[model samples]
Target: MIGKLSSKEGVVNVLVSWLPLEDNWYARILDENLTILSLYETGDILLANHIKLENFVIKNILKLSAIYCYCGNSLSTKAYGLAHDQIRKCLFDMNYDKSDIVFNTNSAQLCSECDANFDRVNLPEDFKKNLKKDLKKLKKDFFYRVYDFVQTKPKISIVIATIFALFINILSNYLYEIIMGRANLPIFLVSPFVVIWNYFT
Candidate 1:
C-alpha cells in the first residue's frame, strides 16, 4: 500500500508498504481542519492501478470518490494510509500547479491551461526540430540507464562466481598438495572437485 498528503501550499508527503497476503484498497480525505488533503491505498496492485488516481486527486477532489470506488474492492483499509503518504511525496516534489495535471484511467494529459500555454510557446520550425532531436536523445539516455540497471545484477553474479571458483580451485590444490606431500594433482581431477565443493559449501 502507498499513501500521501498534499497541502494547498504544494507540500506533499509520501509513504509506501507491501503485504503479499492482503487485498487492495484506497481512500483520500480532507484534513480535519480542511487545510490539507490525503490519499491512501493498500494492495499488491495498488501502486500501479492508483497512480493515475493520485494524479486525479491532485486535479479534483470529486475524483477522489470515483477512485475510492475503483480501488475499494482490491485493497485493505491499511493500504489507504500507505497510498496517501506516497501521493503526498509526489505532489510535494512536483513543480507545476497541481490543477494543471489531469488523470485518465487509460491515459493522462495536461490540463487545458497547460495545453494553452504550451501552444502559445510558438517555437520556430528550427527550434521545434531541435526540440525533437533533444527528446530523442533523452529517450536514448533513459533506455541506457534502464538497460544498465537491469544488466548489473546478472553481470555481478557471473563475475563473483568466476572469482569464487578460481579461489576454490587454488585452495583445493593447496590442500591436496599438503595432504599428498607436494605431489601435483591432475588439473581435471582438482578442477571438478573444486567446482563441487564451491557449490555445496
Candidate 2:
C-alpha cells in the first residue's frame, strides 16, 4: 500500500525507509520493480558498520536484479525459494539473519549458479554480465579498506608505522638542530625506542 503514494506510473520505484516490517529482514520485495528495504537498527545496521547508505542502496539494486530475473516479477515469499541455503556471499543468499547483510554489502556478487540462471531471464543482452562487473562499486570506504588491510596484515602495518615514526622523528630532530643551531636533539625528540632501550640498560 505504501507504493500507492507514487504519482508516477509505468516507472519502477523502490521506496526505502526504516519501517517495522515482519521479522525486519534486510529488505522485502513488495513488487517486481518496487522493493521496501528495512533498516530498523541504529548501530551495527549501517553507521556503526561503516556502510554508506549510497553503497548499501546500490548493492540492494543489484540484488533486486537477480531476484526479479529468477522470480519473474512475483512478490510472494515462496517465489525466492531458489535462494542459496548457506551464506555464500551470493546476491541470492537467504539472509534470515540481519547481520548477514554485511556479507552482501561488502564486495558480494551473484554466485555462478545464480548467474547461470540468468539465461532463463528475458533481460537485455549482457545485462547480467554488466551487473557482475558493477558489483565492484559496492565496496567499503577508504578508511575501512585501510582498516581491513591492517587487520589482515598486522605485521606489515606495524613495520610501516615504525618506519614512518623513525622518519618523522629524524626529520624533526634535524629541523630542530638547524633552527636552534644545536648539535643534538632532546631524548624524546630523537626516538621513543632509543629512550626505552636506554632506560632498560
Candidate 3:
C-alpha cells in the first residue's frame, strides 16, 4: 500500500500504512521530504489516550522539518542515529524498541550532542530553541501532566495546592463581605456551606 506514495518538491509527504515495515519499525524517514508511518501492531504502544500513532506522525514531521531547515539537502541522514539508543528523552532518540516513543514524545529535550550539532547547523538563530520547545509541548494531557508533577514532587505539590486554596479562600471571603454586606469573613470561614445555603434560602 505504501508504493503509491511519491515524494514531491518543496513538501513533506508522510504515508501512513498498516503494513509492517522492515525491523518492525513504527516509522522510517525514506528521504528528506518523504516518511513512511506504519500502523501495524501500533496497539502495543500502550500510550495515554491512544497517542502512539499521532506521536509517530508528529515525530517524523518535526524531525524532518528541523533537518531540512538546518541544512536543506546537505545533511547526510535524518536525525535517527544521533541519539544512538541513549533514550535521553531527546527529540532524536533512536528508540529502537519503538515503544520508547512514549518517552520521546513527553519530556523530550535536546541532548548535549544534538544541541551542539544544531549549533553548527545552517538554520536561523532560534530554530533549534523553538524545536526543543515544540517537542516538549507534545506531551500527555494537562491532567496527566499535573498528576505526574504531583507524583514526582509530593511535598512541593502539596505546598502549592495549599497556597492556592488559601488564596482562593481569602479572595472569596473579601468578595462575599462586599457583595453580601452582612457576611463576615469569620462566619464564612467557619461554615461556608451553611452560610451560603442560609443566605439563599
lDDT of 1 by residue, 51-140 (tens): 344433333332232122223322223323322212222211131223322222112233443233335544334533342233223112
The order by descending lDDT is: 2, 3, 1
Q: Judged by lDDT, which candidate is best?
A: 2
lDDT of 3 at 70: 58
On residues 6-123, what C-alpha lDDT tens digit does candidate 2 reach at each position? 2222334566777677766657767646678766772257677788867777777666655554555434465466588789888777777777777777777778777767776686
Model 2 compared with the native: what TM-score? 0.67
Positional deviation of 109 in candidate 2, in angstroms? 1.2
- Say which prediction, candidate 1 or candidate 3, comes out ahead on TM-score: 3
TM-score of 3: 0.68
Each candidate's root-mean-square deviation in Å?
17.1, 10.9, 7.5
Off by over 4 Å in 1: 1-152, 183-201
lDDT of 3 by residue, 1-201 (tens): 332222233666667787899888877777656677786766457354345456556665677666666555422354554656788877778878867777776657788988888777577668777887777667666787788789999999999999999999988888788678865555646698887889999
The regions of model 3 sitting more than 4 angstroms off are 1-9, 41-46, 49-56, 69-79, 124-126, 182-201
Give the lowest summed-lDDT range of ten residues in model 2: 1-10
> Model 3, residue 58: what's the lDDT?
68
TM-score of each: 0.23, 0.67, 0.68
Candidate 3 backbone clash number = 0
